[model samples]
Target: MPAASAAHAVPPGRTRLITRPFRARRIRRALFCPQILVLGLIASAGAAPMARAQDAAVKEAPARSSVAAEIRAQVGGKLRDFYGPRGFWPVWVEKDAVGPQADALLKLIDSAEADGLKPGNYDPKGLRRAIEDADGSGDPKALARAELALSKSFAKLVADMRAPSRAVKMRYLDPEVEPRDPGPADILRAAAVTSSFEDYVEKAGWMSPFYMQLRKARADYGKTWADLPDVAVPTGLKLKPGAKGPGVGALRERLGLSPGGGYDKALAAKVKAFQGDHGLTPDGIAGPQTVTALNRGPKYYARALALNMERTRLLPGPWVRHVVVDAASARLWYYSGGKLDGTMKVVVGAKESQTPMMAGMIRYATLNPYWNVPPDLVERKIAPKILDGASLQKMNYEALSDWSANPQKLNQSSIDWQAVASGRQELRVRELPGRSNSMGRMKFMFPNDLGIYLHDTPSRDLFGKPARQFSNGCVRLEDAPRLGKWFFGKTLTTDSDTPEQHRPLPQPVPVYLTYLTAASGKDGVAFRPDVYGRD
Candidate 1:
């Protein structure tokens, strides 16, 4: 969301209403008036250079003014807001030639695909043609068009880099977690005021270290895999050290190893490295599953890299102290002083109940927390079991009348179990705080609309699993007490038997719950399965 300071900024509607209509009238007058229109036509058609020069000398840049009118008439909204206030001046054109910024912008547009953006979306070819046209003739109209094109492209690139695109949002984004998309007016105003437009385009305030890391990984992987032929190791053929066959040759080629190498230690090491990167067991053996993954090849990995890069674009900027949960890999990283302090395996949501990408501040921790079961689970899982003669007390379940602080407890026998099971009724069900409670001992609170938080779990066995997507949207931490110590610099404990005991943190730590189906490391980008189909 935009900050309170952003609300203080002038609204686009106010500026546009004041400027657009006035510009429109000026443009109409410049076009419709016979003498001015004739001079404009002469300047554009190049029919009478002497007459055009005479007119230019008298009116001091009448051609540029006429071209500016054309530009004003051609654009609206943020573009109008951007150019109108500057007296319709050309930003990318100076002294009748395209500025260095125009070239830099074109280069950025060309390499946008490396940032997981489609370069074609910004029309680099069209922009290149416009620039050439502008530079060749130095015609005011051509230069004006070129300048407008550059700004349009720059705005698009800025918007794409700042946040995920609409299609990406539809597929992978949770509305509660979506990054704020900067308004076009803001994007342009920031660039327009910069002393070096080229530097602004390349290294804007929004580019963070993590963003650049993903970008570099994307480039590295793209180069490695882009031209490699999609060759598959023969199905059902397993290759280990001391084995010699066609499958080993294919595996070597797939991994970009020398074609002549046998299944030696070097080839086995490469296979292990590949397995580690692709989230398979690194046993130095090329098996059926590993072969299948290799067959997925360049195209598959390229798209993965691109999507993850876009995902990185939506994450919060570099923070000195924060917690990041990579939901795709089911891992958590705690950072302090902008360096990784610790990491742990975490159990995230299963495919049906996906842990969403979100960010918030961890303001407090709750000791001996009650597990408030979500309404859907109450209806779909608990009520049915209870209807089939399961004891609520045995399962540590309690039914509350309402969510209010001083609510009465509901009589379990009086409730319509059938209606609840069939979804006709709802219950505010919670598990009692104890050893058997779903929220094991403690939970970290990061207040969000989705009710997602980090907490300990009674079922610790899942932490040892390679793919630990076993929760219902909330993240179940492997070591909640360890995380607590990280926050407070001391072990957090409560002697009180009270449940849901909230303890405010010494300071709020930003927690970013992000999904990266592909992440960068020494082994390059380790690609993970899109468990929730978010990729």
Candidate 2:
């Protein structure tokens, strides 16, 4: 009866609730309730899964950020490594790191490499031909020469990377570590005093009596001398109160002359002599400049000595020699048979117009070469002159309207010269090849884009000045003709009829123009004034 009732109570599509004992029914309800509660709790916890997924995404973001930072650091490190010591990478580095011109240089570099022009394997003629065919326009030969020079310069830089360490680490003397109050004798000892001036006189090389007396004065005053204040004479050697003698005695007392006394005076005289030799105003008074000359730091002296040694090493192992210009010193040395035969003062480029430090082989000497004014000069100086109608004819400027944008299309001939002077139209001017040309009579070409080359200047008087910076960029040599003769292996008497062509020497002479603050000599290392103030 109960089964029949349950079946009759079941609705369509509904499961029948089976009837059982009261205790069993209660147990089944309890189990079903617990299962329903468990399902409800799982449905509520489903929202937490999204939060876990978000947490995982956040963790991954940091890892990606870290990778990006690592990549940037590596790039910067490589750039510094390539550019720091050698300094040849500045142009390329600056181009790549900043400036709108970066793409142009990158393109040039790519084209150069793609054409089979490697650093050490430069084929100027082949490169020129390839560049001409590649672009189908522009001066390919000039471009090729420039690229070859850059490659060679880069190779030299690579070679220099293998140079041994010449740098010295300087340790600052700590005040606490140093003696709180050093005695006079202790101070003298610390200053590297070996013996008295008298002892030096007796044992050292032949020195004049005057020099010996100076040394004595220095030694006598060494005891009372405080810090050597450049020009201050030593102190402590009490002279006769009334003796009116040479300033040597006074200088000695000021210097704190030590026993066996001539060291200080000798040092002072040497300083004065050095000043005189270097064309400084020799005042016998040790000023900042004098002190700098006397005690150039060990690091500076060491670097100078190292570079000089390098120069000597690079000299060709033969009797054939050429002119070597030490740009930093503003001096040109003539070398022959592995010896410096003569030296002459030169007016090097100014601080702003720094002569580049580079090495190259002089390929050709152009006599009476046409001076194509650098584009910079043309844009800056000549353009203004043309606009002002500043007598371009007087200046031997040839107006080349043919190169203008609308040469044949526009009526350039109808443009009034006087009216155009009033900001009417653009103009271009070029100087023909002649004596008055900016590149006077000759130009020694190695081809570099630093706009650096040895050339003659129309303004010869500028050479006589102490500092020459009158060029747009090119290096103007005072004796261009002499240099041209030396390079071409021809006499100055050679006539104009001589064929204008490069006469290759039996062996190419490598010319290096270097900048150094100091150089080594027989006596010791000599410090040079930072003529260009590069450092």
Candidate 3:
């Protein structure tokens, strides 16, 4: 009876057996319960995962956008800064270092680009190499190389910023360490040094370091004129007004003589001594040249010193370490290290077509180069001769066909050859390659559009003259063959051969043909006649 009662009252938690209807209902409830509870758990798990994924996407989107935006901003800023109204530092420095330095920098940049360096991804190392290779330190070309290297360095910095990993924040960079802002003094000095006329002044010995010292001494004497000791004016001694009395006294004292004695006798000995040391006239009286030396101050001396230093900047330091030509002296000297190698006379350009001041490498040597006469020469000289057949024949002139002519077609007959003689005509003539060519036996070319070069001349006798400015515009060397040999070495043999036939040089040698008018001397300064009237 108890077992029957237990079966009948089996609870839902521990049931062993069930009725069909009850079992069906329980199974349904089980299915329904699992469906509701499992769904809730799955939904809860999915909620966190979905939220995390969405947050990550949102964060990534902004980061990518920010990186893009920053890159764009930096690039835009760089472009703006480059072309801005304030101008760039390197450009200003270039303006200050006119002549060879400026020219050298420009050439270096151009040559680097030409040598396959990318403009956008410029290599700073390559730029530095270009500068070192083209060091025109005393040669004018040095400035050009320096400027080019600086520009390339700036470009490289900009390029490095493009990569996200390599980006550099440059806003906090130092300004003082950057290229300095040139002042009026720098501008004036640059202008004065680069002036075509200034080249003439520099060539004169007045701008030498020695001359500068003498000038300072003169100025000091002038400032204390009244305190100078007096000596007798020697017979035939001419006294110029405003002469330094104290300078005369100092001169007498240096000669171990007493002042206020016979003025002429005492002053004569002093004048002779001063003249001997100063390369001046031995006369007892001071003249313009002597007085000029005395009147120079420290500033003048510094300027002269700086001028010579600047002149050196125009030369290729290593190659021309033994160069001989002096644009200032109209004389050439060969130097092997510090010793004299040789000397020669030279003919420079005329005033109108004054030789340009520049520096560059000599790329080619022509055994017999044709004379491609310049347009200026045609207008000023050749055109008139073309009109006069007799003169044309004497000059060994010939006409270039329109098609054969470079840059422009030149018809000598069409131009008012006579009127054009006054800087009007634009026609040009060129001599065919031959023994009678104006370039003589050899010509050195640097490949400039300026049409400048150094060459030999049939008129070699001109070198013997005191003032040798007979060429149309280019420079004529007295010992051109010797110079050619010096540059080309064994390659420049009497036998005809390519430049490579001789000794193999690791690098190409550069030659700069510049027109400068000042240099230093042992005694002080030496003046040369401006054969071209460029002064």
Candidate 4:
């Protein structure tokens, strides 16, 4: 996630491009609207021609020839498997005309780039040409070849959109949870049996709403770049609030301020807001870094949005209840009953310990939970302090003999602190449940092997910062009790000093931890810093 480019910055007295044209209040509204409304929107845009399965005249099944059958055999893979069951007859061509399904499919293929796919991969021009030749010549072999080509192209698009390649998967690594991506063969089989292939191809009913929203966002950003004027902030120019120079004037113009005025308080406030939105320090000073980010035009942002869409394709297709913790934005979106219920700030893992992207069902919550000190933290920070004569009691820590239901507490004096600090010995250290405890009051348990879960943190002040990435691979919720109420449908409370007290939820909620550097909102697309540098 590169910083938000000057794409939003506009000349002084001119409307801010970032704020004016990119503000997609309507787009955000359409996202949660009913599916029928969304389909209507697509139809109105001339993108998807409404295709009614019942209205199309049903023609007799075409006869298969030995030559076409041989060609189908030669064209192997999912195409062959799909065509094998129904013989090598043409599905897209009927007599002398191309079917509506073929028209919709070719149109979709032409606009594949909007969905983060290469249109050339589908070879839209070649496909259209082949379909035309087959329709004109009425050659059985040509028709069979065209049929296979269309199917093959559609299958590839489905496969690509469903899941990214292994290289992309490696970059967006979520080893513990495997997102379900149906194979090409299964996709073909399902599409072959669908009542309306035209609707499936045009409306993309198979895709999740979340994915479609991002696709729409990509298209919107692409338009922003295409329509953006040739505006650029001067390179290497820095300005403070009281500064006065040609550079300041240039910055003012880029920020859509009066050209003649020096850097004023109003300009500083505007710069601060821009900096905060772009994942930079909000000190109200336009430094070189800020200028560089501003100089990066709208095209960069469009590409970033495309990558974000590609990453989101791996998330659950359609989830009713889920919590999304976006590491890139350091924010959490709580979805209940398939709609966004609430959003809040969150502290994700830092660069040293990047929070992984994975999905798990949060089954229960722990009241007055003990903060089991991570082994690395113990060896690196705690053990050294103990060796330097810091008492476990002073640090509100307890040394346990073993991590069990009822483990004996170990005597700090008897344990070899030097050995523990040197990595030769392992120890089970935990902070007792109290006001000063790291895990404040409670923690949500998803029970993953990665040992990452959502928990209340004692350092609530960190949430006020612009970028909250100060954790050890775990997510720190700003308001845990608020989330608890939403999760259990009631206020959660406990006063017991006892630790590890478990309370099961009324029902499990799926939690998806994804890293999206570029997110679409009412302000169009907001780009954040890739703290973990995965982007």
lDDT of each structure?
0.71, 0.40, 0.42, 0.67
Model 4 misplaced regions, further than 4 Å:
1-112, 117-160, 165-167, 170-177, 181-210, 226-235, 239-287, 294-302, 387-389, 403-406
Best by lDDT: 1
- What does candidate 3 score on TM? 0.46
lDDT by residue (tens digit), candidate 3, 1-535:
1211111110110111111211111111111122332343345447757565445435433432332233233333333343222222123121113223223333333333222245435454465444444333322244344443443343342222111111111110112111122332222222222223122122221122222333333333334332333333333334433344655554455345664344356567565545544456667666555555444433443444334444433232111233434555566554322124566788876565556554444556777466777766677577766666644545766555442525454444555666657775454566655567778777776566667677888876777777665555677888788877766664454365222122322233334344444343344333333444433
- RMSD to native for every prediction? 13.2, 34.5, 31.0, 11.9
Ranking by lDDT: 1, 4, 3, 2
Please give the range of 10 consecutive residues that has the lowest summed lDDT in model 1.
Answer: 13-22
Model 3's number of clashes is: 41
Score candidate 3 by lDDT. 0.42
**For every model shown, what is its TM-score relative to the native structure?**
0.61, 0.43, 0.46, 0.60
Per-residue C-alpha lDDT of model 1 across residues 1-535, encoded as one tens digit per residue:
2322121111110011111111111122233233554564466547647575445434534555666776777767678887787667555654455666666676777777666679899888898888778778878778788878888877777777766544444222223333556666666665554434555455433444456677877787666566766787788887899888788888888888877768998888888877776667889988887888898888898788777776666554332356788888898988653246888999998988888876666779999988889999999899989988898889998898888887688888989989898889888999999998889999998887778899988898998899999898899998889999999999998888898899998877767777888877666667777788876
TM-score for candidate 4 = 0.60
Report model 1's TM-score to 2 decimal places: 0.61
lDDT of 2 by residue, 1-535 (tens): 1211111110000011122222111111111123332343344336667555345335433432332233233333223343233221212111011111222322333333222234234333443343333234223233333323333332332223212222321111212111122222222121112212112212211111212232332233233222443443323332222323443443444333332343354646644554564345555555556444434433443344444433332222112244455566555555433234555554556666766655555556666565655444565676567556566657766555555444342233444554444445454445766667877776666555564567776776765766554455456676766665555556543356342334444434444455655443333334456666644
Using TM-score, rank the candidates from best to worst: 1, 4, 3, 2
lDDT score at residue 5, model 3, on the 0-100 scale:
16
lDDT of 3 at 128: 46
Model 1 misses residue 331 by how many Å? Answer: 1.4
> Which consecutive 10 residues in model 2 have the weakest lDDT in total?
6-15
